[model samples]
Target: MLWNKKEKNKPKNISLKLYSFNEEIIFNGLLTNFPIKEELILEKTIEHFEDYDPCFFHRSVVSRWMYFEIEEYLNKIDEENKSEIKWQELPENIKKILLSDKVINRVIVEKI
Candidate 1:
């Protein structure tokens, strides 16, 4: 936690080529339409992100990190709550980007 503040405040840069194609036009339009907060969340949630060129895999990395973050929070709650809680009873944010059964099993198997 010593460097939590520094890590939280770290700057991220995002850049992509703007082509004259129809796909690029639609992509740029969507980016401009989204509110700033969603954009900020995408920047903050992405971890160990390195994209030298535009790629779909970067989004996958960000999504996986988001799921991992939710899983970590769930682990904390399980440690503190002591009582069992149904997954549906959890908050919406916790259910937003759920990890698959395979991934969940992997986490458990790693602990064994």
Candidate 2:
């Protein structure tokens, strides 16, 4: 989904680590929130977490969020079994980002 200019400009002051079920995509950032609507598939995830409090990054605005799309083909890894490996398999940078003491642990696992 194309992010709006206003949303892109927002500052996500908090740090976080995001990984897909198969560790296919890894996202690290200080995101304020996720988009409310994206191809309708994410509608529910957004609504479920809508009332969720925003972290130090700021209030959960439409902007200030970031995402990373992971393609299993790019990594040449098996996507069938993602939970087999431990968190250590993630990139060092992502690991460090998640290790930050101030990070907010607010993640919802959704099977798409």
| CA deviation > 4 Å runs, candidate 2 | 1-66, 69-78, 102-112
RMSD of each: 16.1, 14.0
- List, residue by residue over 1-112, the lDDT tens digit for candidate 2: 1223355453323333455544444545433333222322233235545534443333223222222222221122333433233455545433332333233333322221
Counted clashes in each candidate structure? 0, 2
Report lDDT (Cα) of residue 22, candidate 1.
28
lDDT score at residue 8, model 1, on the 0-100 scale = 40
Tens-place lDDT per residue, model 1, 1-112, is 1113344433222111222222222112221121223343456445355444425666555554554454455446545643233444556564444322222111110111
Model 1 weakest lDDT span, ten residues long: 103-112
